[model samples]
Target: ADGARGLLAMRQAGARTIAQDEETCVVFGMPREAIELGAAEKVLPIEAIGIEALRMAGEPKEGIGSRGAA
Candidate 1:
């Protein structure tokens, strides 16, 4: 559960977080714990997880979408 604890601590430190939803979880215990501890800002299905993670990482720092410099 160290990973979960670390994620919780990160969220407590004002970081954005996401967890897999119970329905999509193969093992719901870890995410359930994180949610109970207020670590996760949102829980989404696996299918949409990639999109959510990308959103959390924010728009690319320097890539195709990097301002009009491209």
Candidate 2:
């Protein structure tokens, strides 16, 4: 709850966020809290977090786009 409160504060101040998915989390509790509080804009696997952040920041790496494209 405390973490969610802090994330909410940052969010209200125009901060963007990414969160770890339950399957990828050792203690899904905290991340789950922030997610339920609407603090995260994207929730993804731990492996994908960095890639997603880079993409969000407009600095994507080569050969990583649409990882599972049809």
Q: Write the per-residue lDDT of candidate 1 for residues 1-70, one digit (tens) a residue.
A: 7768888999776677888999989999999888887788888998988898888688443343446644
lDDT of 1 at 68: 67
Model 1 segments beyond 4 Å from truth? 59-70
2-59 in candidate 2: lDDT tens per residue?
A: 9888988887666668889999899999999999999987899999999988887785
Off by over 4 Å in 2: 59-70
Clashes of 2: 0
In candidate 1, the residue pairs with backbone N, CA or C atoms under 3 Å apart (3 or more residues apart, or in different chains) clash, namely none
Clashes of 1: 0
Residue 63 miss distance in model 2 (angstroms): 29
